[model samples]
Target: MTQEQWTAVDRYFTDLLVPPDPALDAALQTSAAAGLPPHNVSPNQGKLLLLLAQIQRARTILEIGTLGGYSTIWLARALPSDGRLITLEADPKHAEVARANIAGLSDIVDLRLGQALSTLPQIAAEGNSPFDLIFIDADKPNNPHYLAWALKLSRRGSLIIADNVVRNGAVIDQSSSDPSVLGVRRFNELLASEPRVSATAIQTVGSKGYDGFAIAIVTTDQ
Candidate 1:
């Protein structure tokens, strides 16, 4: 699709799917000021997160990346009054911006600044309380590692949403040797064949690009 067409579609989907929220608007402003890469989840994707959280009546949600809290705010907003969300970010500066954006919502959200690879293990060691919903949007090259970690922390009915799986469709081109694309391709293959979960890859166009993502739901049998 042309860029304009893509933008139109995104706007249509988001408008029909989710209404504007003050917190999300503020978070977007913070993200812009931080000069961080536009890593925040898309509005339509955020709506999807909200829907998934509600579907599972998720009490504990985990997100591996917090980009100025734009996406974190979306996910946290969906939680029940008593529900909690733990988000990890490696950049202290980014975390600071995210914290500021997410101010006044500490009762339901915890923003941890550190390498997710390290923090995830620590969190797992502390308890066996599995997450009902896990969103992975960290470094693309670590997609495989993150998936492995996410599965361990996932409950039988949990959902694991991995963003940027398509890498702008570069994943299908074997000649494309970008580490991020290669990593995503491998991760997709692994998940597609794994017996533990069922997944579907959906193409989407938005600020990210003509890219797509994978949403995997862990089966009860596994």
Candidate 2:
């Protein structure tokens, strides 16, 4: 009925479905104590990410943003003991907070501190194996560029997800000067034209308000 109602329903269903997650709660508390923005994914969304990784049986995951490593932990926990998740964060302070939050996950979590545009090239140059799943949630202005890199670094059958695509219904305004909206428009066009992946955007509303995420699966024919 309303955003408040939607958010309340999200919390209601989350409590009825997901078991208690003290570690995740602690991570949020620590992040807040460190003065990080309260921009982490809600519990239900985090659980969705965890389940997505599990369903894909992903061994290697690449995340374009590591805001306090909240989502990073959810993805990491979905991996096998030897599975790895590499997250990129441009903010040194956020990266540091993420490192502290993921202290025991050193074996499976790799936090890279630098601009994704720069670090992604290094990863590609290293000739590292392609990530099985990639999550893009960084600066909205660079989403098109990020999608380009995501495609470049992904292998066939890889899953690519980009968050915050629909910012409060602003994505439909083509004439809008908002850089994020313009960037998402360009990114959506690119996704539509690219034959390398099959994708769709799923709109969502809840604690985060109106927004959507784009999910693409790399095709074998690409």
Candidate 3:
């Protein structure tokens, strides 16, 4: 269907299912006021993440992106009081804004400021492996690397979620030279061939336009 139709349907569904919260609203407004890219997940998607984390009964979560901490808040809410969530953001400015947005959640959410590649190793070295859930939503060009780290940081039965895989359906273009497209293609190939996990992706459309999420569960230890 048309983008207009898709957006309308998404709005209807979100309005019906996801109630407005002041903190979440402020996070979006503050991020916009700070001129951050509007790359945060939509309300419905955030709710989906919450539900997924809850469904997995995740006591520990790792998020590879922290854009103003919108999605981070949603994920963190799924945790019990003692549960932990570690989120990484490369840009200092973005991290600063996210820190403010997630002020009250400092106890449950750890906002790490650095490139994911660099910080991921630190997380591993810190004995933070075997995260119950891992969400990868950073730079698309590094998705395969993130997937590799996700495997390293997760145990069997850990849930791994990657966003923006469809890229408006550009993923099927074998001749595409765009680094993001190439990376997602490679990531999908790796997922398909990897015997350790069963994975799949579904195309989605809404306020954010055409994209999709790749979801998998670690079926075996790496």
Candidate 4:
């Protein structure tokens, strides 16, 4: 009924299903201590990402945001020893904090510091194998751009997930001047017409309040 209730139910389910980890708690603590916006996904959502990666048997992952590395830790743990996860962050302060949070995973975690707009192209230039899973959770205005890059960097069957798509139902306000809301609107429209992937969005409510994520599977190379 209330956001509080939603959050409580989420935490209850998480405590019952997910094992507690001190490192994850430490990541959030360090992020807050560093005065970073607690924009990271909730613990249940992070675990969902990990589960998706595991189900996909993802050997390569590309994450467009790395705020404090909270989700990064979860996703990284889903990878095999030889797998790699590259996360992009624009804020140097956030990246530094994330580096500390995920220090033990340095071998498999590649935290890239810079605007994803620029760094994504660099990743393309390097011409690595297609990513098995791609997660986009960065600046809202660039979501469509991130999705475009996700398509470019993916092969058939690759999973692409975008966070904060519902934006508390603000996505329906076509005239809203809020850049983030407008950006998600544009993205929804784009996804509706994009034929390269079969996509859908799922609305969710939890400790982070109401939001949603878009999950798509690359259906074709086109």
Candidate number with greatest lDDT: 3
TM-score of each: 0.94, 0.97, 0.99, 0.98
lDDT of 3 at 52: 99
Clashing pairs in model 3?
A: none
Tens-place lDDT per residue, model 4, 67-174, is 999999999999999999999999999999999999999999999999999999999898864999999999998898888899899999999999999999898888
Instruction: Write the number of the candidate with greater lDDT, choosing between 1 and 3.
Output: 3
Residue-wise lDDT of candidate 1 within 135-207, one digit each (tens)?
A: 9988888899899988989879899998888877788998887999988988898898888999998887885
Candidate 3: where are CA atoms >4 Å away?
none
What is the C-alpha local distance difference test score of each model?
A: 0.86, 0.91, 0.96, 0.93
Name the regions of candidate 4 deviating beyond 4 angstroms.
none
lDDT, candidate 2, 93-161, per-residue tens: 999999999998999998999999999999889875588999999999999999999888889999999
Backbone N/Cα/C clashes per model = 0, 0, 0, 0
Clash pairs for candidate 1:
none
List the candidate numbers ranked by TM-score, top first.
3, 4, 2, 1
TM-score of 4: 0.98
Ranking by lDDT: 3, 4, 2, 1
Candidate 3 or 4, higher TM-score? Answer: 3
